[model samples]
Target: MLNDLPIRKIIHVDMDAFYASVAQLDNPELRGKAIAVGGGGARGVISAASYEARKFGVKSAMSGRLAIKLCPELIFVKTNFDRYNEISKKVRHIFHDYTDLVEPLSLDEAYLDVTANKKGNPSASLLAQEIRNRISTEVGLTASAGISINKFIAKVASDYNKPNGQKTVNPEEVLQFLEDLDIRKFYGVGKVTAEKMYQKGIFTGQDLKGKSLEYLEDHFGKSGSYYYHVVRGIHNSDVKPNRIRKSLAAERTFSENLSSEIFMLEKLDHITEEVVKRLKKSKVSGKTITLKIKYSDFTLQTRSKTLPYFVSEKSIILETAKDLLFQEKMSNSVRLLGISLSNLNTETSKIKVLEAKEKAVSVQLKFEF
Candidate 1:
């Protein structure tokens, strides 16, 4: 089944602790020290943690106070977006030297399709090493890469080795590699999903592969099919260079919790205006409007309505948001409120769809990269 499919060389490059590393790069005093970027205040949340901080169980999204409890000597630095963006551009410039098929997942990571590269390099593994080396030398930051036949496998392989490392899963080894993979390591499986898979006795890719498609679908709904295919090394999604924006959102976290609906309505108007401004700047409209509420306790709730036609006007969006807001009573005092528009006009058909099962092609035994 694997032999007949078309093969492409894909590399997923992820920077190691980007924000914290960047903070260290510019400040020699911060180097080799436990440092976290952002989350310096009473209500602050850590954005990124350095390797030194990570050793003490400090990590991104953990509260600043808790991070301090874990690593008492942890240093907190303010986020510098301009500096991060400047360095990110330098890294991306290096990527373009190899291939134009670069799809940036964030300022710190991207996927590059090097099947047909400008350098004519056949070995994706070597290309990954060269790219990492360049990043280290030119940008002064380390990176980890995963090289494989498809995006899914490549993404997973990149993490096998962390903090300055690379892993290559050759075409022939794809099956065994995935089968041996821990179920929790699959990219899309989060904590809740991993627990669910464990309860179903799916502990590894091999275990997931054993379940029939119907059995998986019955238990896992739409995601069950995804699990069944990915375990079999059947992911055919292309690396899209021009990925479309799926949604646009604007939100505000209040300094103090607002308990009154009237005050919430005033905040929603401002958020709706920001959303409209962004939508107009992007030249896109959306059919769906979603209202997000985050209570003081940090619990989140979202209400969405998909309209028959697209809308980008502030008045229309505000009206829809108000409707969704009033539809549900407040569960608790709200700390945050947001408005988002999805199902945008910019969405189009995918560049390539997953090939049908019956389709067959000649195998490239060499598997160059």
Candidate 2:
């Protein structure tokens, strides 16, 4: 039904090894080597590791001791989430420039609803390219993008190329793309799910498209609903516009350019305190810390880090942001400083989750209506 419906433009963005890549970018010594961010201690779990480290069998959530055994020279640095979180915000704002319909999957990936984009662009593929270019040039990070008529196909397209890559599935090409797709390549199709599909003689999208809706529901239960839509190459999910304010942050433009380290920290403390006050009133708890800086010549940068758990303390947020600021010596004077906390745990998000299910039903009802 979706394939037959009037085609709408969509884009999916996925960042490659975001945390580890950023570390390699800032520190030239770690580039092209098996670098894992975490400790070599017995309990240290790899928070993020470079692609090079992955080849050595290193992976996130794996123990550091095991990682070293895989790659003897495996470099392990303790995670500094304060920096990564800051960069997340910078990229998000950049995405907003193209479209307001952005659904962030995590710190590194998102789905963009670009059907009626602000840029007046007709081609979704061209829009995806422009967005990827801005991310690399403005944010100093490479990102992979996928463009298609719907979110499901867009997501599949983005991963076709690795870092700094993009691909598109236009209306005319959708059927061919689906015909050649492996069942495993479909998102949400786990190995177990794929094996089950294989049992049902479904190895590809063509096989899947041949199955009747009732037969699919009888075999796959709830997943049948998802699959029925996927075969047609669309995810009927809407981009949620209700952006719950997790952390309130403000940036002030300084009359005089400030270059001193102590000056930066002093400004950070003030901004962080403002964030904490908003968190308290909103009854929010977040462990991740983010810092944003704007240069006088208009170059912008951000850094952030996520903590093991949620915390809304002013001292903790400020300290984390302060560490990131100090890590990058402010050679050029900074014009503005801002702070925000993500991975936040709030009652608002909890409430929004409940609403999402109702919203999904409402979306379906719209078509029925």
Most accurate candidate by lDDT: 1
Question: With candidate 1 superimposed using the best TM-score fit, by how many Å does residue 102's alpha carbon deviate from the native?
Answer: 2.0
Q: After superposition, how far is residue 191 of candidate 1 from its true place, in Å?
A: 1.3
Writing each residue's lDDT as its tens digit, candidate 1 over 267-305 gives: 999999889988987799999999999999999999999
- C-alpha TM-score for every candidate: 0.83, 0.66
Task: Give candidate 1's TM-score.
Answer: 0.83
* Local accuracy of candidate 2 as per-residue lDDT tens digits, 1-369: 553564566789998889898898789888899999875565466888888998888999787888899899999876665677788889899888876677887789888866666676667778888888888898888899988877788889998998789988877788779878999999889989999999999999999999988989999999997897777776766665445656656565565788887887788878888788767866878877878898888699988888998988887888888888887677588888888887777543345434543433343211100
lDDT of prediction 2: 0.79
Model 1 global lDDT (CA atoms, 0 to 1): 0.89
The lowest-lDDT stretch of 10 consecutive residues in candidate 2 is: 360-369
RMSD (CA, Å), candidate 2 to true, equals 14.3
List where candidate 2 sits over 4 angstroms from the true fold: 243-369
